[model samples]
Target: MLGSAGRLIRAVVDFALPALCALCGRRLAEDEVAVCMECLTRLAPACAPFCRLCARPGPRPCGWRGGLCSICADHGRQFERHRAYGLFEGDLARAIRLLKYSHRRSLAQPLGVLQARVVRADYILRQAEIVVPVPLHRTRRRDRGYNQSELLAQAVADLTGRSCTPRILRRRRATRTQTKLTQDERLANVRGAFWVGDPGEVSGRSVLLVDDVFTTGATLDACAAALLEAGARSVAAVTVAVAPAPPTGRGRT
Candidate 1:
């Protein structure tokens, strides 16, 4: 029973010194993470009456006739559809920043759960046969020590009971960061950057592409295009958050 004793000792230590909240640095109760319940509740809620194509807030309900946002209709995207847990702002944005740039992997669990919840509630993820995170290039993965999208996809797969094929998609090129780039530049940067590991694996399967943020949709579009090229029956996207596009006058369009 030495192993059991060791487990008990570890449990006791954990109980005595609970992990602190990652955001506020306050002592967390058992099972709490960097985000406390209070702060989590404060996050902006994303619900119905959203565009069917882009998941942006819409004035009309998501009726059967295929709800499409004006922007989405004007400029069709490669992915079939997109959804996110919340608008990127406040603590949500901060958490994403920490997870992506600061290497705080712990945030992935909560964010993934949140994304899965949104997907389930919206009925978007139920049809997905497999989940694939937007793969990072080998160089970037090595530098970061982990792929944040993979972590998020794993959590989503766990919650949804779907298989997470982390290696199904591969990044062939190490591209520059998408941040601070124009939409055209982002598109150019990601072109020819991705490939499929096994085309047959996803053949005739519905794939769910996962990522941390939906910016100009360039990254997700690239990933979705690759998956479709690999013979995926259909491809959709789910992200932790969606940044509001700036006004057309400000170069968003």
Candidate 2:
């Protein structure tokens, strides 16, 4: 068949080129996006009732009643609620790291597609008037040459029929990396680090913030607070993955 011949040729071309599945290194089909079909499905682990505020994954048989996690229960969060697609481990972890650190910019499309699925499932997010990725500082963006979160935001915006508004939120200054900071330290670090660049764009409108991971709630919360301060009606957030609930009594981040 002509179609079969075309697919074979394309697959051959993909093999000869840089266009392969970032996760498995398989030559991608013409219809396939960033990740292959198998890996795309693998990304959508069940997101049961998580913390209404911080978006932490609940334990097995998680008895959450749309309530707060222990960590979130005691603290106030800037965003009303948040959700994630899967736990940040295993294949999901590998894919994100490759996309982020290895300069696999092509992976953004598939990652955005995965994030889009989560948006469709959440009614509140589905109604978001605009989509914004957590912004990278100017210095960081210059170094990386692209913001992965913005790449994901653009894809989801295309799918959701909403505008991607990167200019609305700005990182006023770069802060320390949050890799090993405790919850309190994270809150302190990102505080006063973000603000709305333009008030007219977000006023009285619901905004959906996107990010790659939800380790500490600090970054997303900080971003949401800026939107709210700019007169945005409400702010909600989504992420590709969330860290597993720590084995003991506290957050891992």
By summed lDDT, the worst window of 10 consecutive residues in model 1 runs over 244-253
Q: Please, what is the whole-model Cα lDDT of each candidate in the order they appear?
A: 0.79, 0.80
Give candidate 2 misplaced runs (Cα > 4 Å): 1-18, 60-66, 245-253
lDDT of 1: 0.79
What is the C-alpha lDDT profile of model 1 across 1-253, one tens digit per residue? 1244554675576568767666777776767766777666777766667677877664455542457765566667878889899877788888888888765677888888798887787665678999999999887787666789999999999988999999999989888887767767877889878999999999999999999887667788888889989999998999988876554412221
Query: What TM-score does each of the candidates earn?
Result: 0.84, 0.87
lDDT of 2 by residue, 52-95 (tens): 66668676425554476765766678887787878888888888
Each candidate's number of clashing pairs is 1, 0
Best-performing candidate as measured by TM-score: 2
Candidate 1: deviation at residue 188, Å?
1.6
